[model samples]
Target chain A: MTAMNPKLIALDWGTSSLRGFLMGANGAVLEQRGSPHGITALPEPGTAGFEAAFEALCGEWLDRWPALPVVAGGMVGSSQGWREAPYVRSPADVSRLAAEAMEVPTRRGLSILIAPGVLSHPSGGAPDVMRGEEIQIAGALRLHPQLAERGHFLMPGTHSKWVDVRDGRITGFETYMTGELFAVLCRHSLLGRLMPAEAAAPEVAEAAFTRGVEAARHSRPGDLAHQIFAARTLGLTGEMPAAALRDFLSGLLIGQEVLSALGHSAQADTPLALIGEEGLCRRYAGVLQRFGAVPALQLGNTAPAGLFHFAIAAGRVAAAGEPAR
Target chain B: MTAMNPKLIALDWGTSSLRGFLMGANGAVLEQRGSPHGITALPEPGTAGFEAAFEALCGEWLDRWPALPVVAGGMVGSSQGWREAPYVRSPADVSRLAAEAMEVPTRRGLSILIAPGVLSHPSGGAPDVMRGEEIQIAGALRLHPQLAERGHFLMPGTHSKWVDVRDGRITGFETYMTGELFAVLCRHSLLGRLMPAEAAAPEVAEAAFTRGVEAARHSRPGDLAHQIFAARTLGLTGEMPAAALRDFLSGLLIGQEVLSALGHSAQADTPLALIGEEGLCRRYAGVLQRFGAVPALQLGNTAPAGLFHFAIAAGRVAAAGEPAR
Candidate 1:
């Protein structure tokens, strides 16, 4: 049998979704695949279930490149996931994250390095933690080296994160349940019943979203709980169209998030880095700009690049690497 | 059959539950019945479905008291309910709510007066409205006439309301989705997964709840979305026990609501009137007191009494009427 060569396989395994990327040494994607079989989808906890799911997703690539190293992150490292990778407390850097990576044995004798999440504890308060986001943070730092000096990074998603980075390390962070709360309100609450069943067009939503952001900006920060009810009353009075209620809600929530994040720090005048999907990042950028903060947008997939960066940092991949093309 | 006589049938038909009261002329409850067949549970909308659910729950009582007028409130008066009773704009008094009541025809040739909800619009912001709570406010006014001069009333429920009363009229009000948000978070979000399935004991929960209130009091208002994530991280770090998460969440939400309410009004030092069920009102009072606001607690059922007050104000029953026992 001929010896096969590949640079690396990167995986982002969250609670309900998984994405796998096969990449070249130059950080170019060779192939990409995804599945709903995330860490939560495993039939059971432990190595067997993790191995089965991983094999189903990337076994063919492993068969081809028998010695290729695999890098993974996200909920797959939590206590509930395949193996518990203890969180490295912030202020954490790429080196600290790499040092805390846990190794798991695969049936096919392949190397799997799982990156650890970072936890932050404020003075005299409960702690906050993030897993896969740490990887994305690393990737963002690599792409925009200038961001390493000092900046706030906003990652929008379910449990959106606002991270404080100083000198290339995550000094501290906080999580906002903005996305998750939006989903719940839309699907399970009375406010959702008033919205149109289908989402409004992007342009229509963007306008309503702008109105929501403006409203949030003008209102007192504590009034968020009160302001949210406007989503219902506006529809009731025909002031806001029914189709636009969803976007308006999205804006209200995201606006509150931005306001809250700003309230915690005095960096509103400085440029804030946005790390996430293009659509969400664009929306967040719009809100931040409206709220008097300069927003610097970063688009594209960061998890795979982040995993690759982690692998290099951990010395699993050689510093000077080449594609096998 | 002889024309039967009673004071009035007071009904609280909300979105998800119904309560019917057979009362004496002096506002004494002679009989009471309730069911989960709220307006939303009606087999249909318009008159037909509402009649079916109403008859199923209170048909026998109505049959006996053929001449008794029925006063209904809550979502039963909303556009989605049996009939739409237009909202009376604030600053409105009990007389204004009574004047706006809409009468619907019934199979038994009886009059059913549905009281109107109240809507408040701040000069340049979105409007806020509440239905059943309007009746509760009227009842509170009757019980504590002093409140009519000037007072802020806090009604804790799914959509908690902070109402301002001045000079015998409801000047304005704000709605907070605190209770509803708590339910959604505990039942649908990732934070819920960390809480104990069963609720904690009263004493244990009280301590945790107090901690949550203190935490909220010290933190910035807009940080609630961020603060909620503590429920998960605390459990992860074993800083907070799983059984206590539910109460802790309850405290966090209620604390935010109280804080937001206080932020809107200049009457923080004045005692805030609490109108709701005993358990929830007690919790709100505790949080309010902990946050340095004086809480004036009102217990017992307010809906029925409010309905009777509306009936009297609307001249449905004579001012000097007596029960035909």
Candidate 2:
């Protein structure tokens, strides 16, 4: 006989978009739908509007499977979200919510559960914030027990994160605004003049990139302006092409990430796992490899995969204390 | 009586714009004309096109005063200009250029002298290039013979140059892309989102500027990105307003100048003369004062004064240098 339909809704609501799945009790996606709406678009009188939007998007499938538990994640749980999910200090697990997971009562008598985002910050340390991504990380860990043993998980996106998972728990993590900076620099800075509007090719100016990376390693982020001038002069002097300059800029940012990770942890042999766009993911992996960290796994559908793991853990289909696969 | 018509055409052709003053060999302007065209806008044909466009603007004036000797300065003498004006490495002066001026035969039968710009690279140093501005510095030195003994000149603009003039020659200088970077960051970066198209009020975030300057004094220029995130987070935490973040970014760049300058020069009492926009000049003065360098002169019409000094030294004017007040 086929497994029964899952009872919980695993949702990923980010700053610019949202994704949700109606899973069977077995933790497999039964019906899925995503919308353009995001936490940023939520108006004041937050929960009421959020609940209505949430129902309008997922109510049909829910009506068919009545009384399904809904577990949401992402920016929707932020201060501007359906509810302000308080930040959880680092060294947290699946069962812990930074703050009370928000529960919104729908007009249709449906109950909605929103997962709290996590903030992993060491004392006198740089802080990391995640709403839905932490849930995804947790889910990913649950789905892959082997990955939980010891490794670096790079969840790359708008605000890419580097998470360290050890013994089935998120030991710690850091957020690097790599994607955001790249976007802003390419689309908004003088550097943008050289970058084509669309994704074209990955042409690395090894020398320039290496220089930038070295700068990042040795200097703080504020030094980018001077480095930028150096790079521009390189272009002006015909030492590098404009396109190569773009690549060099990207490499500098990635190099900074690699250095930041190294700063946080001294694990040299620890395997690396990358999750994000294939091209960017490969580039990051390349950067890691160049920095001497070999990747162990690369996941393509990080959001859905992580969400699946989350649902299984929440539904008890994957029993607590069971080692992650 | 009005000053006698000066003998030469004093040109200030920079990266973005060009200005010319026609003199009657007496070091006094008879007519003045400025064009949007600059070395940055000139075609690759070099001299041919540059001469054509330049002549179109000042040919008639030259026709009227056929014996006028034209002395040009600025980017028009750069490698990309009408003709390459070889850089006169450190500690060179008007006499140095007098021996190497490019003599261009004009259509109006006038002898045009192109002043060679200064190229200074102290021992194991970064190369700095200056063209028309050097003439102004020369003029300032001529005006103030005492300043020739020792002092610093702050010629702030698109590419602000801080020149160390000693013994009536530019010994060395450092170029800071403060203005250009500010333009790119404000007009092309996310920071632009904070302010409208118009220039913002100067003191919007005096605190961020001061803080950024302090940060720059201690940190390397390569580490700017991390500090940017600090600004962003400050905004996110509601501790810093978005508008103030603009000031902070501005501070970061200017602060880089302060720190970068320290490593180049050892003189603590070298007087600084600011020649640029009054607003930016004021800010730099304040910044320099913070670092313990007080302004000795604040020039309002630097180009004309620079041309005057350069002309007398280049043999276009036979007048002895006057003492600068």
TM-score for chain B of each model, two decimals: 0.92, 0.86
DockQ of 1: 0.67
**In model 2, how large is the Cα lDDT of residue B170?**
86
Could you report the DockQ of all the candidates, in the order they appear? 0.67, 0.22
Each prediction's number of clashing residue pairs: 0, 35
What is candidate 2's DockQ? 0.22
> For residues B1-325, could you state the per-residue lDDT of candidate 2 as single tens digits?
2655545667777777788887553355677898877877764356676777678667776666666556778777777777667767768887887667787765556666777887664443224566777887877776677788897888766667778988888888766667676676566554465454444355657877887777666553334444444455445555566667777767767877766665556887777788777888888887777777778888765676566666666667666444212
Put down candidate 1 lDDT per residue, B148-218, tens digits, no spaces.
78888888888888999998888999999888888988999889888877877878888888878877777
Compute fnat per model: 0.71, 0.21
The CAPRI class of candidate 1 is: medium
Winning model by TM-score: 1
lDDT of 1 by residue, A1-325 (tens): 2332458899999999889998776556788899888887885566788888899899998877777888899999998877788999999998898899998888888768899999999889889999989999888877777888997888998889988999999999999999998899889987988987877787887888988888877766457777888889999999878999988988888988888888887665445888888888887887877877877756466787788788888876765553222
